[model samples]
Target: MNTQFIKASLFAAGLLLVSTSFAQNKNDLKNWPSGYAPLEVGKRIAAHFIATPHTNFGRPTPPKVITYPESCTWYGALKFAGASRDKELLGQLAKRFEPFFGPEAKLIPVPDHVDYSVFGSVPLQLYIQTKEQKYLDLGKGIADKQWGPPEGPRVVAASHEFYKQGLTWQTRLWIDDMFMITALQNQAYLATGEIKYIDRAAKEMVVYLDSLQKPNGLFYHAPTAPFYWGRGNGWMAAGMAELLGSLPKNHPERARIMKGYQMMMASLLKHQAEDGMWRQLVDDAESWKESSSTGMFTYAMITGVKKGWLDAKTYGPAARKAWIALVGYIDGNDEVKDVCEGTNKNTSRQFYLDRKRLTGDLHGQAPILWSAAALLQ
Candidate 1:
C-alpha cells in the first residue's frame, strides 16, 4: 500500500479502538485520573480560603471582574466534584452566591455594566449539577436580559462595553464569550430541550470565528484588531472543547468547526514562547508571559488530546511543558501570580503588553483550574 493508504488505515483503526473503548467503559470514562476521586482538588481549593478583614467567610473578592475568574474556575471544579463524587461543598459555594442574585447582586464599578456573561455561567453550571430550577431561572433571566439580537447570519452580542467615550458593541465578540455564553447556552439546551439556545450559540460562534480568522489561519483578538491575544484564542479553543462535547457527532457544522480548531492550534503552537507560556499577544515576545492565557491554552490543548481532536504525540509534550511553566506562576496556596488584570478593548501591540499584572488573581486561577482539570482527565 502507498503511504497515504497506510495513514488512512491507521486513522480508521484508531477511531475504531476509541469507539470500542468508550462503549465498553462509558461510566469509567467519566471518572478521571485512575485511582483519584472526583472533586478532590476542589475540596483542597475550598480549604485554602483565608478570611481577611475585607473578605467575608474567607472568600476572596477582588474589586475587578477580571479577578473573579476563580469563581468560575471553582465553579467548574465544583461541578466536576459534584458529578464524580456527589459532593455538597460545591453546592454550598453556589448557595452562598444565591443571595447575590436579582436585586441583591451588587454591581462592580470598573466595567459600569453588570457582566451577565460571567455571572450567567456560574449559576447555569450550578443548575446543571443540582437540578435546581431556581438557579436555572436566575440564569435564564440574566441571559434573556443581556442577550443581544443576532447581528447577522452568525453574530450576536449579549452586552457592550464603553471604549473611548463611544458605545462600541460591548458585544465585541472575543474568545472568552465561548466560555461565558456558549457553555451556558448548551446546558440550557440540555436542560430544556430547547433548540433556540443552541441555535443562537452556534450562529454566534460562527460569526465570531469568521470575524477573527487571519490569512495565516490564526484568529485575531477581535473583528477589527490585527493582534491575536493568547487568552482570547484560549477562550475560543476552550469553547470549542466544550462545544464539541455537547454537539452531536453528525452535526453539519462539526467538521468545519473541528477544522478551524486544528488550524488555530497549528498557529498557536508556532507562537508559544521558549518558556512555554504565551504572552498577552501571542506573536510578540517582547510581551511578558501571562498565566491566564497560558493556562487556558494548556487546557485547550490538553482537552484536544483527550477528545482526539489534537494528536497527543504532537501536542502533549508542549502542553506538559506549558503546565510546568504555569505552575511557576502559582503561589503556595495555588493562587495565580502575574496574571494580567482586566483589559479594555485595544487594537495595538503596546496596549496588550502594558496591561497590568496582578498576583493571585482569579482570572489566572480559573484557567489554572481548567488546565488542572484537563490534566486530570
Candidate 2:
C-alpha cells in the first residue's frame, strides 16, 4: 500500500469516530436535570414574554416603535414555541403580533439602521412557522428596505458608500450589527428561499469580520473601543452561528465565516469562567458574571456541537454547563438576572464595568430562549 493512502485511511477513521461521538453527545442533552430541561425553561420564558407588554430596552414605558431588543426577545419566544411544538403557545405568540397589524401598525419601525431592520426577523419567523402571507409581506418588506435607499431620517453619511459596496445601506461597524443585520437577512432568506437574502448577509458578514475581528478572535465594542464587552462579542458569536446554520455549504463565504466563528468559539471557551459564566468584559477577570453574554455564547456552542462544527467532547460539556449556570441566574420571577444594561460603545473600560446589571431585560431574556431552542433543535 502507498504511504499517502495509509495516512488518508487513518484520517478518515478518526473523522468517523469523532462523528459518532458527536451524535451520542447530542442525544445526551435530552437527559437534562430537573428545571434545566430546555422545553420547560423555554416555555416558562415564553410565557413571561407573552404576558409582558413591549417595552423600550426593558423600560416599563413602551416605545412608540418596536425596537430590536423587544423584537429579538419576540423572535426567541417564537423559535422556542416552534421547537417545543407547542401549538397553543404558538397561537398565543401569534396573538401578540395581531396588535402590530391592527391598532399598533404605527409601531412598526422604519428600516433604516441595523437595529430597526432586525424587527423583520420576528415576522419572517412567523411566516415560516405559520405561512401567513401578511407575515411574509411584512417581513420581506422590512428586509428589502434595509438594502434599499434611505427611508428613515437617520442615514449615516457613508450609508450610500456602504451600499455601493454590495452591503446594506444601514451598515455600521458596531459588533452588534453582525447579528442585527445578518439575522434579518438570514430570516428573509429562510422565509423566501431567496439566494439574494442570504448572499447579502454573507457579504455583510465578511466585511464586518475583516474590519472588526481582532487577532485574538474577539471583537472590540467598536472600532474606537478596544474592550471585549461580553454581550457585544456575544452578538457576533450568535450572528455567525445563525448565518452558518443556514448559509449554503458550498457558498464562497462559508469557509471564511466558519473560520471566524471557530476562532471566536475557541477564544470564548478559553475565557469561560470556572462557574461556566463569562464576564461582562470578557477578558477581565474581576468583571461581574453576565447572563446575556453567557446565554448567547451557550447558544453558539450548542449550535456548533449540534451541527458537528465543533468537537463534541470538548464543546458538549461546556455548552451544557453554561446552560445550567445560565439558568441558575434566572430569578424567582422567571427573569434572567445580572444582564448588563443596554450598552453603547465607549473607549472607557470604567464605563462598561460600571454599567447597570438589569433583570428581565429582553436583551437577557432573548439569548436564554435562543439557547433553549438551539438545544431542542
Candidate 3:
C-alpha cells in the first residue's frame, strides 16, 4: 500500500470519530417522546408568546411599559425561532418590536433599575439573530446605561454609591438582580464580542454569589429578608447558568461562578419535590409548588447539562422530569398556571405563600421557552 493512502485512511477515521462524538453529545435528549420533545414544546410556546398581548404580570390590562418578564419571553421566543429555523416565526417575533421603535416608543424601559435594564437582553438577542444594526444600537444603549454614571432627574443616592464601587448604578444586592443584570451584560457580550460586557457580568456575579449565596447554596430574598424564596433563588440559578454558558473557560471568574453554580444545582436537586417541581419557598415542603420558579430552575438545569457544566447522568433526568411536569401546568389556553404572583422581599413566609397564583404570567412563560430552546440546542 502507498504510504500516503495509509495516512489518508487514518485522517478520515479520526474525523469520523470526532464527528460521531459531537453528534452523540448534541443529541443527548434524542430519546424524548414525541409529545414531550423540545421542538414541539418550543414551537407551541413560541406561538403562544407571539399571539399574546403585552401583560402586566398576567393581569388583563395592557402594560404601560414593557416588563422584564415580557422581555425575557421575547428573548426566549427569538432563540427558539432561530434554533428551530422557523423564519416565519422569527419575522413575526421581530414585527412585535416594531411598535417600540415607533408609536410605542415610550414603552421602552429606562435602564435605571435592574428590572428595566434586563429589557436590553431581548434586543441584543434580536440583533444576534438578525444582525440588525438598529437592534444592536437599541440594546447596547440600554446595557451601557446600567453601568454609566448616575444621571437624569430620577437618580437615587444608591445609584451614586453603587457606581462609585464599580457596580451598576442600579445594583440592589437582590438575588433576582443577578439574572436581571447578568442577562443584559451577557447578551451584550454575545452581540458585540466585547470582553467588557462579559467581564462586568462575571465580576458582578461574584459579588452577588459571595454576598447572597448561603452555606446551603440557596439564597435568601435579601440580607434582611431571611426567607428562601423560590423564584429569587431561581433567578440566581438561571443567571449563573446563563453567564457560564458564554463565559470563556479560561476567564478568571469562570471557576468561581462555576463553583457557585454547581453548589446551587446540588441543593436544588435535593429540594426537588417528588413531582419534580420546586415550591414557592424551595426549602419548605409545605409551600405550594410554583410554576415560574420551577420553570426557571428547569431551564437552568437544561442549560447546564447541555453545556457540560453539569453531569448528564444526574441532571439530565431531573431536567427532563421537571420540563414534563412544568408543561403539565400549562392550561388549555396555552398559559402556564400556578405561577406565583409578583413578589417583594419580605421577612414573612406567609407573604410568599399568600401571593396570588396566576395563569399566563410572562414570568412563567419565559422560562418554559428557555428550557425548550435549550433542549433543542
Candidate with top lDDT is 2
Q: Give residue 166's error in model 1 in angstroms.
A: 25
Estimate the TM-score of every prediction.
Answer: 0.74, 0.92, 0.91
lDDT of 3 by residue, 90-173 (tens): 999989998988999999978878888899998899999899999999999999988899887667887788789888888788
lDDT of 1 by residue, 1-377 (tens): 69999999999999999999765543231344432332454344444422211122124553433223544565556544554454566655665565555544563212222333555666677777778888788666555543543323222333323222222223456656666666656666666667666665665567666767676666777666667776777778777777766777776667767777788788878888877788888888787888888887877787887778888667766776676677677666756777887766678888888888887556675665665555555
Candidate 2's C-alpha lDDT?
Answer: 0.92
Q: What's the residue-level lDDT of 370 in candidate 1? A: 62
Question: How high is the CA lDDT of each candidate model?
Answer: 0.63, 0.92, 0.89
Which lDDT tens digits does candidate 2 get at residues 124-176?
Answer: 99999999999999999989988887556887778889978888888879999
- State which candidate has the highest TM-score: 2
Better of 2 and 3 by TM-score: 2
Mark the regions of model 3 whose C-alpha exceeds 4 Å error after superposition: 1-28
Residue-level error in angstroms, candidate 2, position 327: 0.4
What TM-score does model 2 achieve against the real structure?
A: 0.92
Residue 346, candidate 2: alpha-carbon lDDT: 96
Who is ahead in lDDT, 1 or 2?
2
